[model samples]
Target: MERISKTITAYDKHCDVYNDKFKEFEPYVQKIKEFIELLEPGMKVLDLGCGPGNVSRQLMLSGKEFSIEGIDLSEEMVKLARKNVPSGKFSCRDLRDISFPAESFDAILLSFCIVHLDGTEMADLLKKVAKYLKQERRLYLSFMEGKKDGFEKTSFSEEELFFYYHSLEKVQDILKDNHLSINKLTKQGYLESDGSITTDVFIFASKGN
Candidate 1:
């Protein structure tokens, strides 16, 4: 996980600039509205890898009154998350270190974060998320699709950052292995901070439902 450590450090260094560059954070807003609309208020939702609290802010403004807590590997990013959405709690923590009790959360959101984890890590993390979610809870994942699994250099940042990519089939296998059944799949073009575009795959899953 040395590369993971390096990525975390790189994010900490560029947290502020990254936040500024991340101008359009509404790509998943409509899908998120639809997902949360099926649930009741006061349900706890964990925003996995919630950079700068972008998703958290949008969710709060959706009028759902969801109790959201965001966690990231970068301390500076968590700081910015707290500043960006004061209503949500933000913490700097690795996904692998999660130890929340079973059924502790009603939903989990992973956006632009799964690329940081490889196949094995993704499987393990999904298993944990499945355990934390209630019997019929949901999971939302938004990632950049890839023809193959690999890494690419940064477009805007000069910090030598690299982002991993995953194919839709690979992600589906991982979810199935972890006992999370995909309920919806949406594909669309997503613009990054540097104006480059990539295919975005949004997957909504439930407890093997």
Candidate 2:
């Protein structure tokens, strides 16, 4: 818990830098567009760990009228999200505490947020995601690919943030266990601000009606 708190504090302190660095990043824009194509205008969408509203902004820019609800652990990030995507609702909330009715969202994005959660927590989150996502709706997930989990300092901050890495097979099993069928899975290399390269995994899954 201490590590998680420190990570959130780091984000709160460096929200601007984070936003500036990622607000225009477009490595995953194609995947994002694919997710957007699955939804119609006026559909309800939830974005977990929506840093600076980047994904929400992209959705809005796609010219679709999506009802977006975004939540982040950092208060500053939430503030930026609200400012950046005024049409969307933003809140500072823990991912574990997310409460909504079953099948509440037409589409959900868990973008690189599960990196903070351990294996058990990740499984629990998938369960909640499955419950909140409407039938035949899509869920997008992005994360670094690996087998180990630990704390590491990034170029943006000296604070050590806990990162949990899961292999493709593990994530596949978890999603299946939670009743989310994989529609597409892709991996790409990402150049972090620290000048290091990391293999990132992107998954698009859907629930069965």
Candidate 3:
């Protein structure tokens, strides 16, 4: 897990830069707002892979009156997130290894995250997360779609500390095998640095219904 450790360390050292470059905060907030509109008040929410807590802060501000927890592997990101959303709890930890009782959360937010894991690990993580979700609880996940790389083949640098381009069919099968039912799969063209566009997919899942 050296790459994972290095990626977390790089984010810890450059939280601000990562946050700025991603520009995911806006869409992240908007997505949570959309989800909150569908949720009942007083629900418990988990922001998985919540980098810097931008989406968590927005969830707090959306007037849902719900309990929320944000988690990330990068301590620096968690520290920045705590500063942003003082009312909520933020922890530095891996999503695959999150520990919570079964049926603990009403919803889990996974925005622009989860694509980092290899297929096997992703499937295992989904099963683990399913244990923590209450009945009808939602799992919102987003990914930049393309291709897959073996865990050993993936690498990252200080400036580019994450990899994407995952197959949609593989992701769907993984979730399906884990008992998380996908309600929707939205695909769009994501513009790259060289002005090229690639397809991206976002999925909304719920406990087996």
Candidate 4:
């Protein structure tokens, strides 16, 4: 819990820096567009760990009218998200406490934030996400790929942030357990702010009716 708190604090303290670094970056634009293509116009979408609303902004920029609601653990990030994506609703909320109604969202975006959750917490969160997603809807997830979890410092902040790296097989099993069928899974190299390269795992899954 302490590590999580510290990670949130770091984000709160460096929200501006993080936003500046990522706001215009669109390395995953193609993947996001593919996910968007699966949905119809005027659909309800939820963005967890929305981080200054970058992904939400991309969704909006796709020229589709989506009712987007976004949440982040950092109040500062929520504030920025509201400003950046004024058409969308933004809130400060922990991922572990998400409590939206079952089958409420047409699509859910969880970008790279699952890196903070361990296996058990990740499973619980995926279950909740699956419940909130309407049947036949999509869920997008991205995370740093690895076999271990720990705290690490990034260029954005001096404070060390907790990171959880789940292997592809582990994530696959968890998605299966939650009844989310994988539609697409890909790995791409991402250059970190600290000048290190990390493998990023992206997954697009759909729920069965």
Q: Per-candidate TM vs. native?
A: 0.88, 0.94, 0.87, 0.95
Candidate 1 regions exceeding 4 Å error are 147-151, 191-197
Candidate 1 vs. true structure, TM-score: 0.88
Candidate ranking (TM-score, best to worst)? 4, 2, 1, 3
What Cα-based lDDT does every candidate model obtain? 0.80, 0.88, 0.75, 0.88
Worst 10 residues of 1 by lDDT: 147-156
Checking candidate 4 for backbone clashes, the offending pairs are none
lDDT of 3 by residue, 23-62 (tens): 3545545666776776778889998888888778777787
Off by over 4 Å in 2: 193-196
User: How many pairs of residues in model 3 come into backbone collision?
Assistant: 1
lDDT of 2 by residue, 1-209 (tens): 78789889888888898888777767877778878887788889999999889899988888889999999999999999999999999998899888899999999999899999888888889899999999899899998985468878776677778888877788889899888999888898987667878899999999983
Which pairs of residues collide in candidate 2? none
Model 4 lDDT on a 0 to 1 scale: 0.88
Worst 10 residues of 2 by lDDT: 146-155
Writing each residue's lDDT as its tens digit, candidate 4 over 1-209 gives 88799999999999999899878767776778778888888899999999899999988987788999998999999999998899999989889998988999999999988899888888899989999999999999988885457888887788889898888888889889888999998898888777778898889999983
Give candidate 4 misplaced runs (Cα > 4 Å). 193-195
TM-score of 2: 0.94
What tens-digit string does per-residue lDDT give for candidate 1 at 105-190? 88899988878887677778878888888888889888877545543446445565546677788888878877889988999887
- Cα deviation at 149, candidate 4, in Å, is 1.7
lDDT, residue 198, model 3: 61
- lDDT, residue 159, model 3: 41
